[model samples]
Target: MRRPDVLVVGAGGSGAALAARLSEDPGRTVLVLEAGPVPRFPPGFPAELRDARLVPGAWPDAPTVRAYPVRLTPDLPYTAVRGRVLGGSTTVNGGYFIRARREDFDRWSARAGDARWAYERVLPFLRVLETDLDFGATPVHGGHGPVPVGRTGLGHPAVEAFRAAARELGHPDEPDKNAQGVPGVGPVPTNSAGGERINTGTAYLLGALGRPNLTVLGDCSVRSVAVERGRATGVVADRNGRRTVLEAGEIVLCAGSFASPHLLHLSGIGPAKVLTRAGVPVVEDLPAVGAALSDHPQVVLEWTPRRPVAEPAGSWLGGALHLSSSGGDHPGDLEILQSLVPMAGLVGRRTAVPGRPLALLASVQTPRTSGRLRTVSADPRVPPRIDYGYLETADDRRRLREAVRAAAALLSTSAFGEVSAGVVEPASLDDDGLLDRWIRSRLGTSQHTCGTVPMGRAGDPSAAVDGHGRVYGVSGLRVADTSILPAAPLRGPAATAVLIGELIAHAMCTVR
Candidate 1:
C-alpha cells in the first residue's frame, strides 16, 4: 500500500476541485477515489449528461444515478436523486450557478462561531471557483476561474414572460442572480458555456490529467476509512472485485451529504446505536455524523403555453425569482425558477398537456425540518436509510403554501398573458387545507442535500466538524463538501461546494 499526501474521496465537484488545487504543489501526491466511471471532458461528454438545456432525467436515470429511498413522512416515501459519477450531480443538474446569499453566510458564521465562514471571508474562495461571464469585472463576481459561468439567455418567449411577470409583481429585475444582495427575477448564471455543462471534472480534473502527482481512480468504491490508534490512516476500497487498502497521510471526505455521513458510519465513527445496529465496532461516538439532513423541498407548477416557444437546446432554467414567502424582512427565503422544459414530473405533477408546457418551481430557501440517515447494515451494498422529514414543521408548511400561491400569482400577471394560457396542475390551490395537502403529496427535493455532517462551534454537540472542516475527534480527517454546511445555502450548492474545496485546499497547503 502506498501512502499519498492526500486522499480525497468522491471525485465530484468539490472532490475534483480539491484534488486539482492540492496537486498544484507538484510535490504532494494527491489521490482521488471516485465511485463512478470517469466521464468524458466537456464537448466530449454524453449528449444527455452534457446538454445544459434540460433538467435532470432527460436521459433515463442510469445505473450511476443513486436514487436513495427517503421517508418524507410516516406514510410517504420518495426517492432522493444523486449522481454517482465523477462530476457528481453537477453533470445532471440544471447548472444554475447561484451563490450563497449574504444571510446564509451570516447565519453560518453566527451559529458556527467562526467568523472565517462569514460572507466576506468566503467571497474570495467563491470568486476563485468560477469564471462569471456576466458579472466578471464586478466587485462581487469573478472573471477567470475553472467553472465557466454565463447568463442563461432568454430565448424562449415563455421564459421571458415569466421574468417579466415577476417584475410586474413588484420584484425588480436582477441582471445577475449570482451577484451580491438578494436575487431578483432575471437571467441566472449557469455552469455552462456554449451549450455544454462545465462540471468540476470538466473544469478542474480534465486539465490536470497530465499532472503526475494526481491519481484519479474511477469506478473505485471506498468501503471505509482506515483509522489507526484514534487517528486517520487511509481507506479500504473495492475496485473491480479487488479489495485494496490505500494509505494516506490525510483523508478528505468530499462525498456530499449522504455518502460522506455513510462513509463515516461505515468506518465506526458515528452514533453508537447506529454502529451497534449495523454490527460495526464503534470507533467514535459522533452523534451528528448522519443526523440533521436538510434540503430545499420544492413544489412545481406547470403551465400550458397558448403559443409555441422557441427555446435553445441548452439549459431549461434560464431565469428565476427570489422573494419572501412570508413577505417579511427575509426576502430571499423563497425561490421560483422558470424552466422552458416541462419539470412537473419532478414534483409529482402529471397531466397531459393541451399545448406547449413550461415550469415554475417554487421552494423554501431555508427549511426548518431536519432528518437523518442511518446505516441499514454494515455492508456497503445496503443503502443508508434516509428520512428527509420534509414539511414536518408548521413554518415549512406555511411557507410552502405561500410559495405555491406566489407561483400562481406570477402566472396570473398580465406579463404572462401572451405565453401562458393557464396553470395546469395543483387542483387544491384555492383552498388552504387542500393546498397544504397538495404540497405535502407533491413536494420534492431540489437535489441540494447538505448538513449531514454539519460544521459548528467546537463544543457544540451537534457539530461534526469545526469551521475549518476538521473532524472533531479525528486527526488528519476532514470534510469539504455540502455535508459540512450547517444548513442549506440560500441557493444551489454546486458553486458553494466548489468554493469549499478551494478553501479546504488552501488550508491544507498552508498547514503543511
Candidate 2:
C-alpha cells in the first residue's frame, strides 16, 4: 500500500475526531488503525454486562482481570479500567460533560509555559465540538456540531431524591450545567442522542467512513512505530498474527495515556535505561514519556434508602453533585458523584415485600494523590504496570472523609429522609474508620486516565511533548490526545480529548 498523508493510531475519541476532520478536506489521505472491534451499545449488550452491582473485574471490557490487568502498588488497591474498542473508553463511560475549569487551565499555562492552552482559547474549540441541547443561543456552544450534547430524560429514582436533598441543603438547581458556568446540582450533560451512546466511533468515524480518502482498520494491533533518522515513517502492526509495515508522511498517537507512551517506548523512544533493559535500540532518550501520571481517586460512600423510590432495576444513574470544596468561601475544588445501584448481596435475590433494595454512591472527583505508569516489558502485548497510589496523601483522605460527611448530611435531610433507610457501606454510623475501610475495598478507576506524555516548554525534562504536542526529539510524529494534558481535569476527559483532536487537526492544516 502507498503512504498516506497522515496515520492515526488508536481510533478512539481523539483519533476518530481527527480522522473525521481531516476527511472534510477531501484531499489528504487519512488512515486510522484501531486494536479493538467495533463499538457495541446498550440493548445489544448482554444483560449480565449491564448489571451495575457486578465488580469492575467482572465487566467484559474492564481492564482489571480481563484484557489489561492493572498492577496495583501497595499504597493503592484500585484497578485501572480502560476500553479497548474502536471508540475507546468513551464507549463504556457514563456520558458526562465538564469543560476544563479556568483555574485548572491557568495552572497548566503557568506550569507548562503554554499560554495558548488557557481556558479562554480552548473554550472556543470545545464549543465548536458540542451542540448543546439545552442552551445553544450562547456563542460558547455550536448548533451544527456533529456530536450531540443533551440532558437526561429518564433519571433514576435515587438521582431525583439526591437532587431534591441538594436543593434543600441550600444548593441552587442549575438548569443547564453545560451553560451559565455555574457549579450546582442538576442533570449532567451527556454525549448521548435519543438515549443511545454517541461515542466517537458513532459520531465521528462512522460518519466519515464513506469518504474515500479515509480508511479505518479495526482489530489491528500496532507493534511499534517505525522511526528513521529521528522521523516517524510508519508503524509495524500485527493483524491477527499477520505482520505488515504501513507507511505515512506524518504519525499521530492517540492511544490513551498509558498505551501511547508504552507504544513509544516499544519503538525505542522512552527512557534510555528502560529501552536498554528491554533489549530495544534507543531511537530517542526521552525520559519523561511515562512519568508524571495523574488520576482522580474516589472514595465511595454507599447507603440504602428507606422507601421504594421507583428505582430502575437494571439501569445506571450518572447523577453527580458539582460543588466547590470551600465550606462557603470559593468555587469548589472537588466534585461528589452519585450512583444508584443494588448491593452485591442483593444481586440475585428479590427485594423484600415491604422494603426494596437500593444503594447510594458518593465519590470525590478531584483527588490530591498522584500516580505513575511504567513499561512492564518491551513486548507490546504485555500491559503496562499501573500504580494508582490512591489515598497516598493526607489531603486525599481528608477530602474524601469530608465528602462522605457532606453526603451523609444530604441523606439526613427531609428530601432523602423520606426515602433512605440507612448507610450500607460503612455498616455502622459510629465507626469513624468505616469510610476508610470501604474506600480501600471498593475504589476503582473512573476510566479518565491522562498526563503520561505531558506538554510543556522545551527546558522541562518531564515534558515529553511541546505545546503543539510534537515529541521532543522525533519529527513527523505528534501526540494529540488526553496524554498531552499537563494535569487531569476535575470532570469527564472525553470532551477535552475531542477538543485536542480538533485543535491538532487545525494546527496540521495551518502548518501545511
Q: Which one wins on lDDT?
A: 1
lDDT of each: 0.82, 0.71
What is the alpha-carbon lDDT of model 2 when measured against the actual structure?
0.71
Compute each candidate's TM-score over C-alphas: 0.95, 0.89
Model 1 over residues 1-512: C-alpha lDDT tens digits?
A: 36799999998878999999999999999999999888545666666677677545433356556777788766788777777787887876778878888888888888778887788999888887888876675567778889888988876677778878888888887887776655577788889988778778888998998998988888999999989988999999999999999999999999889999999999999889989999989998999888788788888887888876665556667578888766475667888888766654322222222344777889987644387889979998899999888877788788888888989999899998878888987865778888988887787778788889989888788989987789988898999999998888878888888888898898898965
Top-TM-score structure, candidate number: 1
Residue 357's C-alpha lDDT in candidate 2? 50
Please give, for residues 1-512, the per-residue lDDT of candidate 2 as tens digits.
56899999987778888878987888899999988775333344333323332233224444312245553347544445565666676665655666666766676677668776788877778888888876774767877776788765425667777888888998877666655466778776777665555667777877677788988887888889999988999999988779999999999999888889889988999889877877778999998888767776555565666665554343244455677664543365556666544544333322222343554444555723276777767787777777766677666666666666677777778887766775655554445577667666766555667788988889788889987789999999999899888767767677888888888888788865
Measured on C-alpha atoms, candidate 1 has an lDDT of: 0.82
Error of 1 at 34 (Å): 0.3
For model 1, the run of ten residues with the poorest summed lDDT: 345-354
Error of 1 at 167 (Å): 2.0
- How does residue 317 of candidate 1 score in lDDT? 71
Weakest ten-residue segment in model 2 by summed lDDT: 345-354
